[model samples]
Target: MSSRKAEPREYHGAAGGFGSLQGIARIELKERAGPGAAETLYRQNKPEGHMCTSCAWAKPPNPHLAEFCENGAKATLWDLTSERCTPEWISRHTVTELRERSGYELEMRGRLTEPMRYDAGTDRYVRASWDEAFAAIGAELHRLDPKSVTFYASGKAALEPSYLYAVFARAYGHNNLPDSSNMCHETTSVGLKKVVGSPVGTCTLQDLDHCDAIFYLGQNPGTNSPRLLRPLMQAAKRGCKIITFNPLREKGLLEFIDPQDPVAMLTQKPTKMSHMYMQVKPGGDIAALMGVIKRVLEIDDEAKEKGLARTLDDAFLAEHTHGFDALRHTVENTGWDAIEANSGIARADLERAGDVYAGAKNVIGIYGMGLTQHVHGSQAIGMLVNLLLLNGNIGRQGAGCTPIRGHSNVQGQRTVGITEKTKLAPVEKYRELLDLETPEEDGHTTVEFLEALLDGSNKGFIGLGGNLAQAVPDHERVHRAWGEMELTVHIATKLNKTHLMPGKSSWILPCLVRAEEDMQASGRQTVTMEDSFSHIYGSIGKRKPASEQLKSETAIVAGLAKATLAHRETRNPKLAWDEWTGDYARIRDLIAHTFPDEFHDMNGRMNQPGGFYRGNGAHDRIWKTDSGKAEFTDPTVLNACGIGEADGRFHLVTVRSNDQFNTTVYGHSDRLRGLEGTRMMVMINPDDMERHGLADGDLVTLIGDAEDDMERTVRGLKVTPYRLPDGCLAGYFPELNPLVPLWYHDKLSKTPASKGIPVRIVKE
Candidate 1:
């Protein structure tokens, strides 16, 4: 018989709709015995006697009764599932077999039970002892030039482990450290650092409560950062004006009927959100922001002329900022006609938004990847910062810039010095403290690392976490790079595509998950994580370790360092790898000494119930620049390459569904968007569809204009007719990553052009 082609399910409007019904059926089917196989495919990663680690780590009696969000619950459920994938199972299966499975299927296959190494000769992975794996990895490191090795860390690991990895890499004489941050929030760091002298956001989650007006630009906090919704809902209830600016009208931004709210649940009424909404086209945020700024300036000028009051905070600007004249000239030169045409927003709407911002005593601006994924993303952020500076809205009680981070500890990972360009002063200080030689040269970023891999310059890779191939754009290029590596080591809790990359010598080292107990040399240890709000909190495992064989990421790093760094004893007498495993406090002490301003007296701070705030420019409106003020940068041309016109093509913007997080696909469904059990769909406006002779549920192929040969055929895709702009089209990422060339990244940040890819669509 021929292989069965899966038929697409049609949408049905119901509380438990067609998609939900199908999901229920799939769940039931998986629970039933099939031949000799296990009844259920889904299993948690935690061992027996699992508890809430986050609750224990929380201050005092804990901030709330429940310390987890819906996504966090899902994350924990997967972490503590009763599933196992032994090394013997992998030994029986070839790499080709594993590659054929879906990403979800591979992940649900189970936890890594033992350390395993890829055997190139047999084309299978074989069991390798932890000691043997570490020794092999160390040997490879010793063989290669320090600069030839790249250390890519993920946000999964605890604070101690990440810090240890950073020290190990620097001691090994290479700063080639490209982390998960390189792909997500690198633009925020780059933009903020240049303007305000800090890479982190200035506001705390508590600030959301006090703001009179909150401007959400280019972000979907409901799906991306659900924890933020509670506060937003509370603010909205208290009559705070919430304004949203994005290309898509996200369901979360519309209104949320909080399941936790008993009154609302009983009444069956949802709180309304977004007093005003504006949908700007892709790459149009800069012009929109500039329009608002220009409106604010005009308002201030009018007030000054009428002798009503000085709307411009001239005193604050003069003392706390620079480059105002150049900024003024640029804004003055930009015509309203150009701004309206480019932004797809009328002058009146932008004027109203500016009025809302100007009228509020305390306002906050929150943004996400939609504002940072373009070629001019950094510039857009700078413009936002400049606007905030003009109003003197930062460093106050309820006002600041907030960049929503993706990963749990993404901000913390970068905070502890994970970067290609390691600041020389800090490295020297660390060297002096540890009595070790510091590497002089800077490291390679994700883009440069890929180039190095392609050219056979970088031979080995140690990915602390994340599926590099799936997460990075232009995955084919990443796949080829993985094939060229001599050694590929993945320290993770579960199996991922990056582990199956098959290097000359590859090892998958099973490590303790975040929700599992991390018993180092220290008894009952805890890890620190910095949230997007800049609040530092402690996290301990709620459950027992998955297996005794599994080690903490800290121990693994120490073992690898011991094996790789030959002259460790000469560095310092206190540098005892064995002793270091016993106590994470010592690591904290080292961190405190290194980042005195941030982590001073770690024990004292951790003992407190609620974690203390890290230092941001919020205490005083002091900018950390060469001129000791916020610098306003104004480029001559907004877009080096002008607005992408739709001659015979549509501008494609890659997006994530409500269910997905980064590259980790929990399920192939988006509950809010009405997409069920399928990711192969594109959202386009009715006008665009009418123009192309397409209807709902029509299969189409997208052809890239960058090159003639680049194209992707997506069949049986439901073309959801929505109120999207005529020239714009939206689709999910990774699958659409093929449409974006690696060479099409932003010139300044080297971030992939994921948001805006010029492509023509046709019926298949």
Candidate 2:
């Protein structure tokens, strides 16, 4: 349950052998899931069982005995834990007292058992009936303009719940539905849609199996998604070249011993994962990708001159894409000096990578937040798409683009219409088919919502799930803004900092998680989740609900909708709230009716064992763009790292430890990084540490260079030397969120540029 209280030490062992087993054992022992633990593990990733609550990796048709990763197991165990935070227990502690507890400590307090409301008289939370909470929330919303309220959804919820959440919001007359994707991969959606006519990844797990090479960029698969390591390891074992570009040499990508591989686990032999690893500088993804693409074009030119087999997929490019001349001009104008200076990669090394890419027949590119959390985040994605297009890697069996999604159903939430963009075709279709009254103007994103609250424009907030206060940048600003809201409602499995940072009137409602049984009136309900690859799978929880008072997300959303829409008039005359909540299939039916293209047979597909894939137009080479072809965007003006002043400052990137997933701090241990007992440590290059006159374990303060006249500093952070790029630094997220300004974000998608934040480190 607790991490080891020892000094940080280097972990030289291969990732995911005995280490993974030990982590799983610790979670099992701490959570005390009893017999349910074993059953839950067995059910994880199974077609008929609940989906893994961790990463959004696609499940294979025939899975290994252990398809779930250590983090996945921990998530399930944490959800199935016997401990409960009852109304009485919460009533005993004041909001101030609970706010003082660390995130990990609050998580350890266990699942919330019932609906509760903040009592100003006692400064504590007391039990409240669902009717009372919903009525009070409805009254407040009725008093304010519908555009002033924002509805946020987390990726943890399934498609059914997300769909109902969107419908509920539309019925309440606003399109302010922002989810987890707004902060993480909004750029992925924006960029890919512009370039490839598809927002989701075009490839599946089968693509990884057949791809000749994979260019993995800006992602730490080991800690971010351990299940992903399996495919990477398998690819490496089969002699497929796995080229990686990341500032930190992640343990999973470097070398990995599969916990499920009996031979490797028994022999303690690790498989070398990344055939070629390039330590790219923070916020340098655009330059790095451009350099590789430039080299690929050069190699193609040489081949043309030599009269050998053409290096580029000329036929595919000519027929399927446009803007090649513009792309070539941009890359040619970018000098090697600037490329090397920005990317922290030498020309020779980049050429070597380009050689591998040019030689490979099929190269699949995978990326994560590293590419999407920058000022030019969307353009960075465009660069990667350009790399894949150069070789005709897309619309094929073994090649395409893959965005490693963080949450289990973040993509799914967006798929089912949880977004602030009212212009999206599917979103508009949902509004049209449902005959709902929604605001015509585009609504606020996560950052815009926070800004509105700060500026006194927004008065109400309804969060389906997520620790918004801690999950976003500018933690202090978010906390302060949240305190000024007139009404805030959160439906979650447990208590978090967001709940403690209550508004004038706040309510916390307990809900069933992925691993719990939800016995609706129609029978035991099953929810569907769409993975990163667009595979939809049915998930029916194996364990019973944590408490009898807990309700399913669909039920809660329906209850709130019924109370809030009682006096409101929408386009839809008849609203059957009880029937929809009683059977989730009705919600799926509406989803199919709204977005028939993707979810035509969604309800029927749930009956299939392995589920079905939502067809992607880009995968089939069906360009739905204005030109009827894929766009090769110009990357000339998208090269800046968004730093205020790079001189004498470190490009600080926020990262998640192995023990945590997003804002949920499972513990203080970052076993993969050899860190324990603390999350308040910065990983810096040894050369940078020497330059700053600091040693390991020295307490330092990081001052943000927002240049906005607002002072931002994270003090007393331990300096831990790492093998990062010279001017780059890595620190755990949320703790370092304060260093990022609210105004700094990707212009196209409004995703907070969490990475490459310029800061000065001062030793205390």
Candidate 3:
């Protein structure tokens, strides 16, 4: 054999700092082909090129642009790889065999070329044709009650594809559409909608630049949303005060050097990030936020007593709000002792933070999953908005609420109506537009959708995109339910474990990668994506499709509709499937007619480089609540159940490593924290380690009860002691996703309890 050895795993240096963390040994967590494997994976996936043509955010000229952040680059490379999951390949490897592989390795294998069906005897998948697959799906739908089918749409889908998916499901006579948003930012939507009329954020990117102060709660933009760093740096350069509150000391929140800045990168200089950092315990956001608001109220009262112009915007509040007396009573009656104890922050610190907000001329509050993945996440977000309204921060230039979103187009997916609960006007307008009957009943949420599948109430599933099996909590239960489906359809660019959970008749339809041009009868087509700032932009692919067999998401949806719903005239009379092929204009026309104020002349606007911004409540200081004002919620004592032991167990908070994003595992490298090639490590405080007789690099096992009876154990994890809270330990998600029970979700939003899972760790 040749003497050329495999290359060692590569470390990309600290994510933000000029140098890596000191004292910590450079630990290669696994024996993967280091950073070279990343490049190899990229070349394999992108036989055509490394750039993503589908994302407007992708940098120009350089196909593998540095504009691609670590996670984005990983996603792009994984999609364009040269691997293939052909029928023959599946026949050789059983479901059990595939299950044994890590999620990262399995997905890295290649694209799913042909439609497939599950074979019980062989315990493997076999090839099937598009006609046969669609016929089987249609037959199943025809046999079952409409409610028996649950349609799921992932953020990976384009607007046209998602709209068609929703239309098809509604026309088929069911409203069981449970989507990815139900598990992520459902709380943001529910809380914001109740307070602001619109479920989306009230601030744009421009607001960040002009804001005097920014309060960041429960969000880590560095890992989940790296692209947001540019704007954040710009805001910091303009002398904005950024205050961050979280359970762990996130490196990204401290300082960052823009990778795009040649001078800064070359000189190894970094921009200062958070002006004030407060370590709030898990599930402590509500109390912490409440404490800040109480301080603000006291300060305003003091200002009034001193005859200084009242700190409170009295004129604005009197003109725009209601429920002030009730709100005032609740805030004043609450004790400072309880706030300090529950929030784990000192009274002085809370006052200082509040003073910062009160002194600022304009302020914006930004948050993410940290606030939404808890039992009282919705209530926590509500408190943030209430604080903003106290100072008349709404309907202003630099002041509003911004919720940083995960997934490139997660916000856009919701914009196109991939919701479990359909609004009446949108449904009625769609019906009038298409001349079809719209389903009125609200569909299932993610939790309910899975339950329906487990109980055999739902027989068919159609996933527009996403790794549902891995993304959902309680993997054992979700995987079992997924295996029992009658028919399953996945439109995707690559293979994941979700695709392997074969239904009786499963179809893994290959779709064009985001970087590839979507060609149609009309000509080359462009798609629209809504960024976190609510700005819509046009994205046209610059690369060719990996193969002629691969189709655009739009084409696939249109094709599926033509194949299944073509026979039904009443449900789809105005729907000439051909007209929608590669023509996003028609879709825009429909969207414009439905949401006239926001999407007016959407096609005409697409020609402009930077698309228009969606109107937000920040412009008019108008709160959309029933009282027409933001209301304060009393801090309530919250309790979590099903944690087995009261002592010796800590809340195992699942977080995204610096290199990864959401459920998509780009690689096993956390450059900012100096972890490489492995994710089976947990961060613990050194003091806690000494008390537990644990040491650095000690092999341990994490055991936890997902439900009352169901338990999960992850073994052979390396312990890495750090500066986490006394009763808290940190681990990466998807790997630890099994420990989170599906039933243990936020009561209001139905989001997985990934942030506060109680578990016991012991020496293996």
Candidate with the greatest lDDT versus the true structure: 2
Query: In model 2, how large is the Cα lDDT of residue 314?
Result: 86
lDDT of 3 at 693: 82
lDDT of 2: 0.86
Give one digit per residue, the lDDT tens place, for model 3 in 1-764: 12332221223343443332211112212222234434432432122322332222312222333444544545555555556767788778887788788877776666767767677788787777767766766666666677877878776676667677777777777778777778778888787777666677888666776899999988776666655666677788889888888887766777787666679878877787888898887777777787888889998999888888666888878887666666677778878887776677888988999999888999999988888887777777877887887888877889988887765566677777677776622687776788877777888888898888778887888888788888888777778888787878888766778877888767777788766667887788877667666766566665556666777888777777766665555455587667887577787787778678888988887545335676766456666777766655544552222243367878788888765656666567676665666899888877778778887778998888444788777788888866666777888888888888778777677887778787889897
The true-versus-predicted C-alpha distance at residue 489 of model 2, in Å, is 0.4
Q: Candidate 2: which stretches are off by over 4 Å?
A: 1-9, 425-433, 569-573, 637-640
- Residue 152 of model 2 has an lDDT of 94
- When sorted by lDDT, best at the front, the candidate numbers are 2, 1, 3
TM-score of each: 0.91, 0.97, 0.90
lDDT of each: 0.72, 0.86, 0.71
Per-prediction tally of clashes: 15, 0, 14
Model 1 C-alpha lDDT per residue in residues 528-573, reported as the tens digit of each score: 7666766666666646666778988888888988888753345555
lDDT per residue (tens digit) for residues 1-764 in model 2: 11322233567898999999998888888878777688778878987778998999987778788779989998888888888889988898999999999888888889999899888788899999888888988788888788999999988899998888887887787889888999999989888999999988999888988988899988888888999988888888888898899988889889999998899999999999998899998877788888898899998999999998877888999999999899999899989998988888998888898999998988999999998998888888999999999979999999999999999999999888787877763656654766555667787889899889889999898888889889888877777878788888999988998999888889999999888888989999999998899989989985878888899998999899888888665435546789988998988888888878888978899746556887899999998777889899898543536764467788888999889889988888888888888998999876677776777888999998876788889998998878888888999998999999988898788899988788889888
Better of 2 and 3 by TM-score: 2
Total clashing pairs in model 3: 14
Is 2 or 3 the stronger prediction by lDDT?
Answer: 2
